[model samples]
Target: MKIDAGNVNAVPSKRLFLSIIADYDLNRSICELIDNGLDVWTRAGRRQPIVIDVHLDPDEQSICVEDDAGGLPREDLGVIVGPGQSGSVATAHETIGIFGVGTKRAVVALAKQIVITTRYQHAETFQIGFDESWLNDEDWVLKVHQVDDLPVGTTRVELYQLRLLLDDDNIKMLRHHLSATYANFLTNPAVMIRLNTVPLEPRFFDNWAYPPEGSPQRWSGPMRTPSGKLLRVDVIAGLSKESSPATGDYGVYFYCNNRLVAPAMKSFEVGFTRGQAGLPHPKVSLTKVIVSLNGDADEMPWNSSKSDVSTKHHVFTALHDWLVTVVKHYATLSRTWEGQWPEKVFVYDDGDITFNEVDDFLTAKRAVLPNLPVVRPRLPVRITKANSGVAQAKPYVVGLYEGVVAARTLVKQDLSQRNWLAFNLLDVSLTGALKEYLVNDAGAELSSLDLAQLINRDRTVSADLRARVPLPDPLWTKVEQMGRLRHDLTFGRAAPKISDEQLAAADAIVSEVLARLFDVKLAA
Candidate 1:
């Protein structure tokens, strides 16, 4: 007997088909068919235009995806149905399709029966049917035949006996997914995609800009995969013009090989709130970062379905620190932009700064930010109750009464503490109200500390605040006296005691400043 090396019944059962189809949904299955046409364009040297049209007939419960991107020849009919057989790999084509199961999985996921028609060069239309019986049978064989005439360089796939219902809501969502997934291709002149008779337009990310003081918003660098493949990464980060928080349009978008793998990610996956202070508040939602990775498709960090990033990939791990730094930088800055947005942000680039749409902003000529080491700024020593024997909220003019109560409670042990506490409260209230008058009414950037220093000495910002805030000379004398007292108390030195009459005078100054700036009376 001739000893033949035993073949171990490697043919997969019909259940494998069920498993494959179950892994995909209606949107993902449709995308797989579109991706097939795109791979054909890449294999054909990408010299000619590729037009794909998707038609949905809800009455018939069928879908048709037709593409003019180099139809399949007769020889490919046999191999395409087989699992683990990829034409791109066999022919050494640079394409996103690495596995051969995409088409088979997509077609079976949509319907129980599929008909594929193709016309290549001079050959007549080659037609093949994968019917319901083929799925139920154990035979791994398929039949192909020549059919009626079709346009050359065309492939059409029609699915019938749909497994799921075709509805208007799902069709609308599919349109949005296709527009965003193939956004880069839609921008090219040689490619056009239409769904249900409507041509899809690219979704552009709108950003905010300020012309004067340049804030860092763009960066580009190179990273090498573990297999030594080079991945060129370009990052554009800024505040969005549309300020809807926790929406799908906000957060970091990750694109691989011009295909959006991940969209609007704001979680630990993109290094948000990982050992840093970040939350999904409206200000943090204003932050938008687009990370585009262009290189070999196999080396990208995307998962199998191209729906999300693989956090464990070496290329993504190499980029974690950079992503974290930029995200935290912009998230912190956006939190401080609530009231100052009008004074600091603009809609368009004004020749001095290049803040435009995300796509154009990346392609336009600009400076490439160097990969500088992130030098964490030294944090100022916090004055806690343990060190300064006092704890108070930072004065910003909105809430001054809380500081007064805290100051009074801190000195309640002394016999003459009531008079001292009254003076301190009057001083803090006057300082905060005067600064508010300068910043809000007078249109200046003044702080409580700046107001105190301005009364004592001459500094550029403080002097400007004084010039902008119009106060009478008598009020200026009271402000000067309060500023001196604040300086002495802050340094823990002894200051002359104040009587009830002086405290009353300081109270009048506080009330006057508040009424002028805010048009509100002091609390009785």
Candidate 2:
């Protein structure tokens, strides 16, 4: 605890201690080297085709990353070799890096030494070397050697004395990690990445581009806020073409300069992804939201790592607050459009909803057939969470929210459009629920015009008919019991199921709802 600031010896710059190198794993180090090459390509704005080839040879006990991108300049070599100094490369698209420590940290984390071979255009090839033994002594300078073998306009990273060994599985994992981390980049035809001479294909997702079918369920042209800032919003919801894992892909992603900085993040305001911020997983898996910032580096929200957004930044915070609700409303629309209550809402007390005594007063309020004031029942409530879920491929959706309804296709592809279902959310004071199902399903799909007209006419008709969606006593009691049962289920307590008598009572309530809300009678 004593202060001894008198004499401090200089450690080999960029401090790569041999012992600390073991702290980082092999895959991460490999990713770091690859990210360096990627940053270079990003700075150039894809004017040239960038091809990065990674060579992982366990037998040789070395890892190499070579890219056809514009290599580091001679003046810039002093920074990477010495410390985590990012030279004057902080442009808008090029701002993903911070302090330029990723490659340095990853190199030191994986091995005791590294040799960087690079050339810029027709410039002479130069090599920079760092050794672990320098930590014990005073060897700060990395001798730069000119070499002729390295290709012109390229850079290669050769890692030796690796702390972690590489096998087939490790190599496979590295490939997968790269695919997920840079999936957005891979989506572009102009950008290509390879592992061991094989080109890695980007995982495709529905609505990634414009839909091949009718049109995007929801699309927003570029909109400018009051502050004169540009914003882009694109939204798609419902079942994936081949819904693989039920919770595979969902949620809104934030992209900076065509690169995904935060994948499927619930906005800071209303974020609901499974297991994060005390919100349950979304009931449906096919929902995907894309909110991107295409502006220059000044407006981007990315941190130094390029993996997260800086919530505290002034400019980004303003833009996010201004445009976040637009995306969230679209998300709500996506979930409610199809009207699957179990998939659309989550019941029980999560501090959002408070269930009071069952109000079965509707059945008594009206006394005739086709009773006007249809008291529509609202089931589970929807919540927003902030965290994201595990990543997935095939569907490019960045799965963030969980608890999505498992996809069970009645008909896989409704090519004729007749099989598609029509439903809309109607705001009703009944049950204090915002979701009101207009039509569950019919033989035909609702055309855009019909949908618009229905939406415009719903309030007028409901007001005129005096429709009140009332939860009958028995059904309301059943739902109330189910809500409590969910608590017991969460607490690992044994819960009992409703008997035939209870079910019959519930059925009677359902029939009443049908009669009052949609004017249909259930079979006996």
Candidate 3:
């Protein structure tokens, strides 16, 4: 007999087994479960008044919630408290509490002990108490008792061993959260919720009353989402004075399945529409943009943590495109209303090579010009054999007069390519030859050399060369003064000083010359 007893095994009862494995965080979990449960209850067409009461006592470190909802039946209590129960599945509707593990598991997560009191309309009130230690103890059991003095239509849940303290700010935020969550219930008047001693208020933006005097212009369009869903857009613009620049004040709200979710940002595609308007007014804050997207039970994009929507889905893409188009359109409208055009215009032509050719020629000349001692005196002097008979000699002495003249010639040549007339006038000022030639050859002896053609053919000639090349205006005055000196010097007359008035006149003349020569307007 003793040997046979060793082969026997003990099997724990089902109730005792699940009780030991119930999860922790029971208090917080129970609150969320109740919230979701109320959502389901309202949607199911339950006519009874639903009330949620939350009580927190920091002194006792306890939190409790009581609801006047359809209490759980005695038979269903096991499934509600037990693990892996799905009571809502039999109802065939999308219940907020889809998984049966919600309330009990959440309660187990929050506190070490919990007590649930429930009463059905026709059934006797029942109380069930469980401790955290009983979850794993094989011999432990849940204490269930029936009572006659329980409230007529209330289900109460009390949690002990709180992990988070509820302060004033937290309470206020909770109230706001509940009001937004249950906005649809406000119109029904059958649902009432209270936290501490204050009653909760539900806020719905759609019902916001407009000012009585203004005729607000309403703008609406269908925004197509990438997922092929047509999201309707509703905008209220012209809320301000029509004659005022700020009259374009508008509010854009997004709704999904009739519930306001979040404010839309301009960075998002939906926000692009607002940018298009180019409204001078500042953009509305995120809190001001009310967005509500209808969420279905099948849409897993909306997880329990409803902070963000799933971007990978088609709905997100569609929403993005719609917003961007709206912003673009608004920007265009703003520009049109302001009667303004873009300040700058850019033109590209493939066939224009004249400018390029000029640039290329200048680059080539510059590369070779630096090496030519004729242009730059600082270049190393080079000795060359003259006919192999004379000793190696430098061709010409580096005289300041000759060097200045050479530099002036190089500038003249360059400017002549673009504007020959300006170069010629500058040359007349630099060289005494212009006056000498004009005076020597009377009106009858004009040569066949067309001065304009000659200047145009020489691309290297420039205004600086003309100004410094011994021109004739006031040249006699300089020459006579030089001749009166003790030693007779054959250096050409000194170039005239360019005064401010002369410079201004030269600049204006050059501009006009270039405009006519190139047949193009010069930009100031």
Candidate 4:
């Protein structure tokens, strides 16, 4: 064979790099190691009683983990603890330990030194000591010794110079986290995990059985991802009455592989109720939708922390779109159910509830109203120039004086109906030749109508009354501008005669319209 080398000193490419930089907490790292070890133990089909015992002494700053798995064989000890070597998942299957570096990296990352002792089923027992300096020292020897008698199948790892300890609270938290993280395994009688001396009790959500006789409306189905993988979705919809209460609780939850991924609806950045859709006095209890993506769905490109899904993944995009459609569909169903029931009669309770609570409740409730048209106050026809010369008919220029006056009247009416007469009123008086001429003529007709109805009628009224009405803009803008102005003030370039009282009244009318149509509180 002829050998030809173009670059003899070329370096081989590295396949993987350490993703985490900072030192991890010792207690947490130990837990992670145990979790990885358990995965390795279970996959080997050892079947022997497996146990993890942790001894923590804060004063000594040391922690130990002993597991009864088929302990490391004498020949495999070096490779098992070697850096960048993975024994788990050499075959195709969903083995929890994808990378073999978990235990080795975690111990080195958390503690100053680690000691390992193992007793194989039919091989001589051996012990090894590992330290940070050993990583770089090729000549450094590991303490390995053969023992005559040892536990049949046990591996013990002792971490010294620990950075932290597991207190009572932390132990409790660890128990909970372990139970949740290994829920499926915890249910298996073959696998047992204990924290300190206490055996962990796994509380799975699926264990909560439904009431037999009285069951909530529920829909359960399997959703297939673009890859043809199945994800389970289950929803428990509230009763029609429950769906639209004046104030109610409604929400959805996300799960992955039977694990609750996100527990609260607030985490989704969307409300549980229909208020998001602008319903007035909305009392819709949310239909609780619970979803569970399959375990294999981890390929969907979830973030490393698993807090959120990556939008770049097609599966995530499909899931997001599906959830949105579900929300909209349920909202429509809730509204339909609410409409079937009698209109809710509201009685203001001033005695029991605090004013703030009442205000907040009202504010939230008002966000659910259906959209309605707004009425603009009609301006009065004003004669700007009347009978300027003798023998001449009244040469009259129509002004918006009547419209301003009508707007004020409608505002006062709305205030009285809504019990908001205490609001501040700025006084404005109209002046200018047009106003004077209109006041002098005294033949203009101003009708008394709802402010909303009037606004709806005249929102399009331009400077030229005969011109077509412009499309109505957002109500909030109009209401805000009206509220900030001084009374009887002229707006726009044309100095039309307007009074402060009229402006205040117009503001009140706009506020009333918004409250009724959109459940928007314009006063504030």
Supply every candidate's count of residue pairs whose N, Cα or C atoms clash at under 3 angstroms. 0, 25, 55, 33
**lDDT scores of the candidates, listed in order:** 0.69, 0.50, 0.43, 0.45
lDDT of 4 by residue, 1-524 (tens): 87876767443222121235143454446555665557557566636656767666556767777777777777777655654555554233334444455576567665667888888766778888867566555543466877655677777788886545546676666666666555656677776777667777775432111221112334445556555554454444322323324333344455554444443243233333344422323523434444445435343334433334345665545455445444444454444334222222111111121111111111121122122223222222121122123114332222222233344444434243221222222112111212323233433343434222322322232232112222144543444354444222333465434444544555555444423422333222
What local lDDT score does residue 269 receive in model 2, on the 0 to 100 scale?
A: 46
lDDT by residue for model 3 over 187-248, one digit each (tens)? 56777777776777776443222222111223344434433333444443222112122432
lDDT per residue, candidate 1, 1-524, as tens digits? Answer: 88989789878886577786777888888888888888888888899999999998888999999999988878887645788676664224446766677778888888998999988756778988887789889888778888997788899999999998998988998998899889998999999999998999987664555424335466666665666666677888766655666455777899887888788888876656746427666766667788888777677777766778898987777777657767776666566554344444444344333343323222333333324333333111221222222122223443554444344334333346566677777676766666555565566554667656654421122445456667666666666766665566556666556676765676666666655655433432
In candidate 1, where is summed lDDT lowest over 10 consecutive residues? 378-387
Q: Which candidate leads in TM-score? A: 1
What is candidate 2's CA lDDT for residue 481?
48
The residue ranges of model 4 lying beyond 4 angstroms of the native Cα positions read: 1-23, 26-28, 46-49, 78-84, 90-92, 136-150, 205-320, 323-524
lDDT score, residue 505, model 4?
59
Worst 10 residues of 4 by lDDT: 353-362
| Candidate structures ordered by lDDT, highest first | 1, 2, 4, 3
Worst 10 residues of 3 by lDDT: 340-349
Alpha-carbon error at 92 in model 2, in Å?
A: 6.6
TM-score for each model: 0.67, 0.55, 0.44, 0.46
Most lDDT-accurate candidate: 1
